[model samples]
Target: FSAGNNENSIEAHIGINGEANLDFLNIPLTIPEMTLPYTTLTTPQVKDFSLWEKTGLKDFLKTTKQSFDLSVKAQYKKNKDEHIIPIPFYAKDFQVLSTPNDIFIPAMGNITYDFSFKSVLITLNTNVGLYNQSDIVAYFLTSSSSVTDALQYKLEGTSSLTRKRGLKLATALSLSNKFMEGNHDSTFSLTKKNMEASVTTSAEVQIPILRMKFKQELNGNTKSKPTVSSSIELMYDLNSTATGTINHKLNLESLTSYFYIESSTKGDIKGSVLSLEYSGTIDSEASTYLNSKSTRSSVKLQGASKVD
Candidate 1:
């Protein structure tokens, strides 16, 4: 059991992130296949709006027009098993509680959340972001960490200089890190009422692997509507060759389909093949309509060894 409060304490920033009041209790778990024999930690936490008025979060939620979320967060983590490859099953998280938000205290419009995806120094509250910080913590649980450290106030501004009639022309700068740490393997998107499609370009530098990737994604504003959409990605590394991919999905009342393809070559011009793969799926279980096949899947491979 654990208890935290700033009322009668010397420090006002009592819990991590200077949260005036915070408390939680962690239950332990044991596993034999792991190194520690004690395998995991289960923590149930609760947050209320007692001392939040002293925080930028008070302004953040107010400006974004979002009510404070008092949801119960049960945190879980499994330590890395020395007997197995080092994959510490913990929650990979970084939150800038105060630093960046101080940049633009008086935000004009749009939701400017505490920046989480970019470069910043991590503070004591488990928020890890120091300029050029390369150490990667294994966090398998993706909801996120409880507290934050630094902050960067991203201007809630939009540029429509390139916008043309009937077509959307815009660009955005959001903060996001690698995928294995957060949302991947599945996709969940939200589109505003007046928004139609989005074209986004992103560049990522993976420090641990010394790898970098540049990608572009296009998404249509067809959530409850039936339409065809596509996303294309391009990537390059210093020691490796360039690669490109084309992925598309279609959702309609009577039909649904998806297609994806990616390839890499040894050299710029005619060169040895490196790897190529593409897969497609068609189904109706999730959609209102039914499919000729409950599920269909396929893949094509090239210039790679296949094992039985």
Candidate 2:
């Protein structure tokens, strides 16, 4: 019989000049083996035994399996408009082994702009990045084997700007693009805002195997203890293929309202209450994908009363 185990870890960092970093790692191990009882018999007698004769049970033996894991990541950035230039860098690496004999490595890197356009209400930012993989090796108790190495190169760029229209009205726009070995992806978003309400929308499209996506969000609240808030999101994707096209869509909506109770020195009591809720999601898949959609929902209701 075989058994499996899983482990996970997360890390975070923050530095001076508005630099932040985050990382996550995971590992899984599995081992399988079999055992059999010894029989009382001579070499000729063993051959005569029907139990051993029916199948190749004598060839079975217990075995042990082992695996290894390693992950490394780091990010640093500093931005100051006073200085003409800004500096930023990010890097990540992941490795895995099914058995002590096999090894794999995946890596990514990024470097971006510094802080010189701070004075402008509307500012632009950009970055260049790359992702690649190294060759893998497999080892056996007696010998070793290696696989042909492969690498992927990527270049990315982005820009965003915000402008104030009037006393309480403002708008912002963002655009980004990523170029891979033989594929390209691009995204754009726009937002309009005012004192009482705001509206925002975004869209993304990828080439070489066409795909598209869109999303929107809205929010508002009042000072009352039992304040109410709600939000909704929608996403869609279209896949082009030789056989046919596959389309997928996801929608999510949620609302929450809650209040608190307080007591005074004279033993007086007060109470506030409201209803809360949430909902949304996409279908599950056999394995994790770089781009996938999922939805979540939640709700709550509670109240308390006091007497003096």
TM-score of 2: 0.20
lDDT of 2 at 177: 45
Per residue, candidate 1 scores C-alpha lDDT tens digits across 128-216 of: 11111122222121123323522312222223322223333343334443321111221223344444554555556655434545555
lDDT of each residue in 5-41, candidate 2, tens digit only: 2222122332222221211111222333333348554
* Model 2 whole-model lDDT (C-alpha atoms): 0.28
Q: Which residue ranges in model 1 land beyond 4 Å of their true spot?
A: 1-171, 174-195, 199-201, 206-208, 221-225, 232-303, 306-308
**Candidate 2 residue-wise lDDT at 105:** 32
